[model samples]
Target: MATDDIKDTVEYSEDVKVDEKQNISQHEGIPRPEDLKQDMALQTGEADHELRERERKLLWKIDLRLLPTLSVMYLLASLDRGNIGNARLGGLEADLHLEGNDFYNALSIFYAGYVLCQIPSNLMVKTMRPSRWIGITMTLWGVCSTCMAATKNASGLFAARFFLGCFETGIGPSAPLILSFWYRREEMSSRLAVFLGSSTVAGAFGGALAYAVLGHLQGAQGLSAWRWLFIIEGLPTICLGLLAFVILPDYPASAGKRWLSPEEKELAIQRGASAFNTDTSNFDLRQVKAALLDYKNWLTALVYTGLNAPLASFTSFLPTIVKTLGFTNLQAQLLTIPPYIAACFYLGIMCYLSDKLKQRALFIIIVSMTGTLGYMFLLIGNNVALQYLGACFAAMGLYPLIPLTLSWISNNQLGHSKRAVALAMANTMSQTLSVLGTQIYKTQDAPAYRPGHAICLAFTCLTWGTALVLRYFLKKENASKDKQYGVPGEIDEKHFVGAEDMYDKHPGFRYIL
Candidate 1:
């Protein structure tokens, strides 16, 4: 069966019904999508090639219109958030006269506002419209980032950091949620990898940008290079935020008046339903409970917190760590580039294979184990080159887990509210841990940060264990559901739009492995 054939021949209805004659194993509950196409071809009275052509065009339009703009938004968000690391090496700490534990406290304080806003910020992505919510938050964070340049002391910097985090909270959780509104689970992992990989690009860019500013712009305007780094990075983000208001579409079904035609919009909604076996429009308290009550959600949150702690700490501290290798500030900035570059390629390959193989847990485990070994090298080795090699391993392993873990939540949960809350909860827990994580690399632990490396290694191992448990419980639940499917009910036609709960609990829905 060709890809286009499935697109052309399958006429997904408003409610997204599958062919009754298709293999409807109540155990798995969902039909093998490929098995339905021939029957669909007979019913729809359209030639496969004709259908394929149209689908190709529609999907291309979506890809072109959505991905690039979103990628840029994410890249800027990352640079704004992670530039603190670059600034540290560029004289930020010294410029503000930060002393004792003040630098670490400044780093950790950002997550205070970050943890508070996670769930509400995501819920607002529903009511405020993704365009408005995302744009508004971006602009606010940019303003806050620019304000960091003016801070004269640790207290002022702490205040700036908290607000920076409060504004940033939306972007991290919201991007995956927005993607969920558009792409199917199978298609999302790679798209998400691309979006997430932008941060790696930002990491590289921040280093180069900081290096350029430090070398050329230092004392140019009676301000330090770190201040200039903040100004240069912050202003553009504000502009990007303005641009998002014009570019980002709302949910596909209602995103009609913009780029998509009425038919295309319907197709987009139907495509979502066909892939997920539920409507994305449904949001409500009950759905929140569904997400909240699922032990799988909490376990996934735990795993995500474990995975995220190391990644977040690494992003904020990598430049400092690399500087310990006897490199000048300039050399340190340049050195940060290779690990980020390595992580970018590593993320692309892992996500490609993950989507192709239709597996998340195994890849997560593989990356987690690689990270564990990297930490071990850092823990035991004193050789500079060997530890640098370990940093590369850690970067590759640690960063890719973010997208995989997010897409895993999308795979496990259905309905808009449930997906939103699940991602929010996981993000919240992870960000909270990130606060504690930042403190792991204290001044006393500097030079090697051995305790930090050890803590990161332990978390990676815990992440692996949690992933195994999550995979097992999901598999077991599917088997139990498969055995107990009773009388069929009439397929519900009404779409739940923040009113009622309807999702994985529906009889015919199946968990995707």
Candidate 2:
């Protein structure tokens, strides 16, 4: 097919979306800006075979260079954030003399710092660049995590956890923005799954690591096993953070200096064609306000919060929950492994299928429904085997929701600043829910924790309602735009650049459902 034809046929993906306004014929006659002229030629020319081959190579290089490093960074970030749960099982409560609700406050306080830092960290990522910003945050949080080993009382542990949350805030919001910088929208779901799947991997790894440290290092070096757990886990994360500073690349246009060759860099820039370009060059309060005012942003946040509450509960108390099935501490840690493994596999499969089929809402609904059933089983089932089955179902369902919701919103939002602010806002609201989630699995609800299970089931149902409403709104907006214009109106890159602060309001942009 010709360049125009190919552009017309291009799917709604992260890398390329078919714009209804522009035509190949018009593009050939238009004079582009000097900096963009080469990129425009490379795109509009009839070098189909060469473009395809180069694109294939470009994607492979990106997948190899980027995914593994980001995945590992996320893995350590998740591990540090979650290790407190494992340590709780390793006697952190007893060691610190945590009184009634002190432990709960410790968990909840982290989210206070977490909620406060998300927006600021997200805004800073663009200015400081991913390498410096993410690297700095990771290293600092690793230090905080290590200090958890030295805490002498509940207050000290609380302080350590709060700082851990502050430094770790950059990660949860940054991952999706960074992914958008590299992959096409269609390809992002699976890549995001890989990145976010770190949480599940951390669960399995955390359990196994806890089992080993608590089993063998109970008093090694005259420090308790919980202390050893913090030190051992925290040190490697610091090392990884230092490595990320040297290795992680910036956005594509600016990345050749970071890693890629000049030729590869050009390809990378072209991959994120100007049509859906997000301006990360400057900060604007208006963009922040726009994201705050946008209903879609808050709606997605609500759905995400409901889904995420269960995940937070699982991460903090899975071992405790499993132990209620009559297993010892060590046995509970070992038992937590299988469900996380199952969740990991299930997440991979669902992300792959979600991308392949080009759908998000259906998959989210199905996953939420499955999680609801899992909680139902946990609440009502009597047999130990059935309850264990419920645990697997519950865990497998919750972990994938965040990534899917993130990719969904990232797909919908148009501007860089808008997306950045929207994502941070979403993260803020979800973490707020997470704070409430920590309080749900109270010390009073020991063993069966029937109340916690019931709350989770309620939230799962809430997820379904919010997701469907968002889907309906997106469809309505698309339909309305289709009615208003017979075809898409013009979108000059010059005009877009000038008004990037008003992204998604333009007639040319369309929301993907």
Candidate 3:
């Protein structure tokens, strides 16, 4: 829409081409090879890699400042999402005098709203500032969570849950858009890990926070401890919303402040500018269809969905899941902390390695297999520590996949518009599965939960099967294109790094996995 004039460099034009007829992010589109041939001639190896390294450091440092704040923000949001679980432990169901799984019905209803938000919310995010949008959502969800403190019955709880979903809509998908502002596709895996890893951090820390608040604040004034949990947990997010407005960087080219020296800032611009040679955009319907129609989108969706049942079962109900091991709710909540702690450790380390190696699928393979084994042990074995240790394994397994999977998707997508829409769609489809997952493990099916356990086991196998298909599919796709698109010694082809760097610079960017 903004392509009034092209910003011409030595060989390529800055206005990425897109046909308005089709729908997709205005960020990616078809580029002519003749244009790229000229552009590639200008790309200096010494200069490009040097500049890339510099920007990488800048973005890395940005995360050092950014991750803690965002991690804390997301931690607060996630705690609110699951606080209902905490409330159950403190007797929310009985207080409302709900009948026949009405509490779970409330959980399912929230996701109904969450399901509608993915694409539209991100589209709005592209139009607005992410810091502003996310902060607003944060404040709204905080209000919703706080209101939960006053809920009198199941109807009140249901209304709170729906509004909670509505208020919290934009934060998740929009987060990737912010991350893309700084990091290149290749760097996304680890950065994504840092972002999503907060879930693990939150899961563990929330339990501790709940344990402390619910334990000590049980009878404050006329409120129940669960109400206090909502109040205390929801309030910090308000402060965090204000903080994000002040601190989060919007985009590399348009970033406010002189945080980096001019030369360093130039490097950030040049890297993004150079990246346009391969992967810049003008959003349109054809490319949008291209993105949505691609096979990887559905394959990736299936992998994520397959993992969802197990992941939510563990993440949403871990304290209750642990209670089956004969621990009190307090002990169960305390024990839940350790697995998520272990998960955080594994997440940080694995993500670091993913960055260092620039390999995503390899790590996906390992984490999936490890998680499968953990779930298997839970399904059949009975030793308490061993079953509990399976939980640590379970925690470690799920945390890393999300970051890498998201990185894989985000990095491969070419432009801002395409990235935003696809990121939202991909994310929506993934969370859409939560609707099924939450309902699958009915309370009647608890304890051994043979059916639920069997279902999770099958899902792990789905992840593995999906991985195998992806590995083969990517290789085949790359090989066929290489036959047509290959040039002798144009770029390194001997080794592949998870499809990000290869396409981040080229619009011919086809999804490999």
Candidate 4:
């Protein structure tokens, strides 16, 4: 079946009772119910085609409006966060008087605020207008990031980075939650790949930008090249944040009032209702309790933790790691670009296949093993060429897991509140480990960084193992549901009445394994 046809079938099935009601009311008791059913059957094919066309247009409009704005916001966020690594090579450490472990401490302290704010920031995104909340946070973080250029010592850098993390938590962790509000589970992975893929672009763009700034602008006006890097990268984020308030849409119920027709708005809301348990209160504490208790949340959080340690080490240390491969400072910065570009292509392909197959855990396992192999090469490779190959493998393997795991956790949860908490909870656990990830690549350990490679390798292996166990449990539960429910039929709106409270416990709901 065509993609639009499948979507039409799902929506039609879910709305069958409503269609029946409309059919019966139109008959006005002039005909028997059987006649109404016959008439409805005749009309169904044409109705499906018309609705599918409208829906296809609606999706295109939404994709155009949402994806680019969110992608650019995330790109700026990634640059501000990761540019510190680029700055490090441009003499940030020497100028700031950072010595020994002070540089690592600077890197790790950002996550202190990051970990603390995950749950609260995500909840705020739920309660406040998403545009306002995200815009305000973006502006604040931009300010904090720009201020890093002014830091005269390790203390100043620590304060700047810590605040930057606090504000940035609103963007990185909150984006998937925001996207969940607009998209269905089947549609999420690819959309999220676009959003998360910005970080890869940031990696590539930051390198080229750093090379230019560090080469030509270093001492043009008495500021170091690293300071100029922070200034140049941080200023554009402020402008984009302000623009978000004007461009970013809120929830579908209220979004596009000026643009979407009433029918389109109704369709959007129904789309959200079909995918999520929408009967519950928006901020129910009970949902929070349910999310905290769900074993799936913890299992996925473990997988996230495993991925983040390596992710943290990779993003912050990739330049440094590349530098150790017998390249000059400028050359190291330039060389980091290709791996990220390769990862971007790799991520797009994997995410497309993931969404097309409607599978998450299997792809996650594949990439985790790929990452394991990457680290194995890095750990023991004898030549610089072999080690560089490891870097490409590591980038390819690690980048896609982020969107996959995030969407998987989001896909399985039912209520909005529960999903919000689950997303934040998983990120909270994973980010805590990221603090340790920052410190693993010690300064003294460089020029080989064997222990760092080994630890990351172990974490990737852990990701693979945990994903296997989680998939097993999810498959088993799906089996239990099929047995108890005797296989689910086409969903109808009637099935959702009072079902929000039951969440994933609802008999009609099935985990997407």
Query: For this target, which candidate reaches the highest TM-score against the unseen true structure?
Result: 4
- Cα lDDT of model 2 by residue, 129-216, tens digit: 8888988998999999999999999889889999999999867789788888787777888999999998899899999999999999
Q: Give per-residue CA lDDT, model 1, range 1-513, as digits (tens).
A: 654566465444455554569744443444455656656767566675776677678778887877887888888888888888888887887778888889888888899889899999999987788988999999999999999999999999999889989988767889888888788778888988988889899989988988898889889779888898989999998998888888888787777556888878787777766555355454578788889898889999998998888987898889889998789988999899998899899899999999999899989898888888888888887799889988988888788898988998887787788889999999998999998788898777779899999999999999998999988988787777778984334323433232234567655555655
- TM-scores of the models, in the order given: 0.88, 0.88, 0.84, 0.92
Instruction: Judging by lDDT against the true structure, name the best candidate.
Output: 4
Off by over 4 Å in 3: 1-53, 275-286, 487-513
Candidate RMSDs in order: 9.4, 9.5, 12.9, 7.9
Give the lowest summed-lDDT range of ten residues in model 1.
490-499
State candidate 1's TM-score.
0.88
Identify the superior model by TM-score, candidate 2 or candidate 4: 4
List clashing residue pairs in candidate 2.
Answer: 13-185, 14-184, 14-185, 14-186, 15-184, 15-185
Task: Score each candidate by Cα lDDT.
Answer: 0.83, 0.84, 0.72, 0.89
Which window of 10 residues has the lowest lDDT sum in candidate 3? 1-10
Tens-digit lDDT string for candidate 3 (18-136): 55676332444544444455565566666778866876687776777667777777777788888788778887788888899797788877777777877777777766777788878
Is candidate 1 or 3 superior in TM-score?
Answer: 1
Candidate scoring better on lDDT of 1 and 2? 2
